[model samples]
Target chain A: MLDRDEDILKAAESWAEVDKGVALATVIETWGSAPRPAGSNLVVNEDGTFLGSVSGGCVEGAVVTEALDVISSGAPRMLEFGVADETAWTVGLSCGGRIRVFVEKVV
Target chain B: MKLATLSAINTERAARRPVIVVTDIGNGEQRLVRAADIARDPLHIELERHLRMGKSSVIEVEGRELFLNVYAPTAKLVIIGAVHISQALAPLARSLGYDVTVVDPRSAFASPERFPDVRLIAEWPDVALPPLNIDHYTAFVAVTHDPKIDDPALLHALERDCFYIGALGSRNTHGQRAVRLRAEGVSEASIERIHAPIGLEIGAISPSEIAVAIMAEITAQLRLPKASTA
Candidate 1:
């Protein structure tokens, strides 16, 4: 629950210290029974490591897995998570919620 | 960069200028000072106030007049109910950047065991509220319809000018409460400040849905211009 600007700056500061490229993911929208609200944040490092979350353990593993791709590619990407997704079966939540996450690298 | 921005915001807030502190990520350990004037700076400045609320306020560069309004991120929501609605509300408000505290007089309901990571106040409002210092930035909601509990808290909230005062009740119940307040000589304007029917007209039935509607209304009110909206 950090604010949008604060989370980005924190990621940048931490990345600067470790000399790792930082990628940020934000939940811009959500559907029924979503665990986190819009504006939820997650920060990822080049090593495929991350801090914070965009879902309640339901979609984070996928997000982190994709975030690593965003960091390596250095390109902003948008991801979707929900019951309709074929990979949704992998995570535990079955409550039928959808979330849209926007990922970008902070320079 | 941080010190200068903090100083700028401090001066503005001390001079009664409205400013907002923007912080990022979880745990709220990082922040930047943001204002109409300060936002023009090249480097982002994170402004953080002591959580102690109302103590020493320091702005450096002695003897210069700067009009600044330092807003403390988002105001807090203090709820006096532990029902299912609160279960949805605590996390929602936290996401919206409000420091949320849920209080229930019943020890069975108020325990931290039930509400993980949420600040729970087991004491009654009269006892618990003073330390919290409910102010203009604070919004209070009393979901428990019990007069013994909600009434005393309502009185305290009205007296303290807590910004948004609300209670969960029907039109009939709120009407009766209004009558009681009038009999006690509380002004009509003051009684009107309470969002009696509570949430917006979303026809919410479930507790979580009700929570969403209430939060949406509060958020809308918080964003509106004070004089125009009132």
Candidate 2:
């Protein structure tokens, strides 16, 4: 229950050091029965290899896709997903909770 | 985040020290705060509170939104006895994601047959504790109720500055323990820190209930504000 590991963050650093584009997506906020807590991270490399979870599996694919864009542009973006959002059907949290993720590239 | 900042955080985590990354979500600016540097940081109050809670939180200051992502070491439980209480306490702690270790000098008590899938050290506290590296993240419990075993283990725990130090004993038993510890050069303040009547005042009569009480007290010690004790 309490096995929180920072291995993903470590992987993010090592990938960036090897000159690979790395993007980190963190759950900055959560509301009403979120699967993951705020500050949960998902690290994505240039090849879309990802570690960790911001919204369990419900929104990781979407976050990884956005992370690739952030890695290329070096611009951070905030993505929100939930039943209440317009993109909910596409990448909404199936757990019925809303989460705001902050996606940023490692420089 | 900068590569240097990320590397610094990984370094601190490798050493098992608490660190926080304060991020400015508005502009994506971020800075790393090591445990040793938190007291001097501009947001020391917020950072210390979040670290004590072992949680990450978002706060607003000066019209800016900041997310504090705390990376604290996993809490460890060092049980100095392999008795009934330890048997119950070990599994409970493990379920809570704590690194639980039971140390008893007696082979019969520390047998793997009795306590399965747990780290059982059949060695004296002096030999067992040093290598365990008990620190502020550890909760040390002396439940052997034997002065020969519990006293030295508690002394080592005190020296290590464990976040929680508890012993399974009544007020009368603890009074005598205090005298013995004082004679051995432990200060009055340090002795006072030990929870003599260990666990919450829940009138726990069974080993399982006592384990729950102890875990509850540890949870309070970990998550509650340092100033709030009752």
Candidate 3:
């Protein structure tokens, strides 16, 4: 967790230093067969560039889209995706698990 | 998510201090909390529990959900022998995310060429262990059969709070070691903590297999319940 998550934080610092809009998405909770465990992070820039992962590859696109909005709005968003949810197919979390990711602009 | 807080987290991590980045999901507010500061923090009790376990987790405090991004110092493996088993053990421990240090007074065995990319301290255990600052996250393994070398290292490891202390020897040798330690005024309880015939009984014969067994035992000691290990 430290090794990879540290990389994410370091990347965020670098991006922020360059004046790029930045947001951080963190997997706050997971239930049953979640690919990545809770506390996994995905750091995103306004340009759609990112580092790290909250879910292996499943929910990253949706998280990034929300993160872009978060960067513009300066508001945090909590997103829940799972196979049981209606948007599961849309978000591609067909792995039979639930994950709650919180995205917030880095201040 | 302040840059100052992120910088503080990096600084604390570089210093090998246990830290937690507590993020309030609702408000997007975050603060860096070091292990030293956890006691005075409002979430002291909860923070300390996660700190000891060395795991990042989420918890609720007064109806607010907070993410605790724990950053404990990487666990350390301090090998006392620099022998064949140490060769295997160092890399294995490194792969398991432990910062490994190989200690041996013998320059021939503790050469950089022999253990490339690994920290080597070519000093006797009594002279070497003090500076290493052995702590709870450390796993101390005495692979050198020589009592002169292994005993002092064991004494130092026991005195400190090393989570695992394993000595490579037969049961007979460990019995003799027990007598020697007792004579040296080391307590029975402290002596009992030593995992003699180190490693799980996986019938390991070669050095690599022995290293695997030792690592497995250390992992069990690290992750399992005390009653289960007992």
- Looking at candidate 3 chain B, the ten consecutive residues that score lowest on lDDT are B48-57
Pick out the ten consecutive residues of candidate 1 chain B with the lowest summed lDDT: B49-58
lDDT of 2 by residue, A4-58 (tens): 4578889999999999999989888889999988878899999989989988799
By lDDT, the best candidate is 2
RMSDs, each prediction?
A: 11.6, 1.6, 4.1
Q: lDDT by residue for model 1 over B130-165, one digit each (tens)?
A: 888787678789887777778778888888767688
- Stretches > 4 Å off in candidate 1: A1-107, B1-5, B8-17, B20-71, B227-230
lDDT, model 1, position B140? 89
Write the residue-wise lDDT of candidate 3 on B45-148 in tens digits.
77876776666778988999888877787899999988999988999999998989999999999999989999999999988899999988899999999999
Using TM-score as the yardstick, the better of models 1 and 2 is 2
Any runs in candidate 2 off by more than 4 Å, and if so which? A1-4
Interface RMSD of each: 12.5, 2.0, 2.0
Worst 10 residues of 1 chain A by lDDT: A1-10
Error of 1 at B184 (Å): 3.6
Instruction: Give Cα distance to truth, residue B197, candidate 1, Å.
Output: 0.7
- Chain A fold similarity by TM-score, each prediction: 0.83, 0.94, 0.94
TM-score of 1: 0.53
The DockQ of each candidate is 0.05, 0.65, 0.40
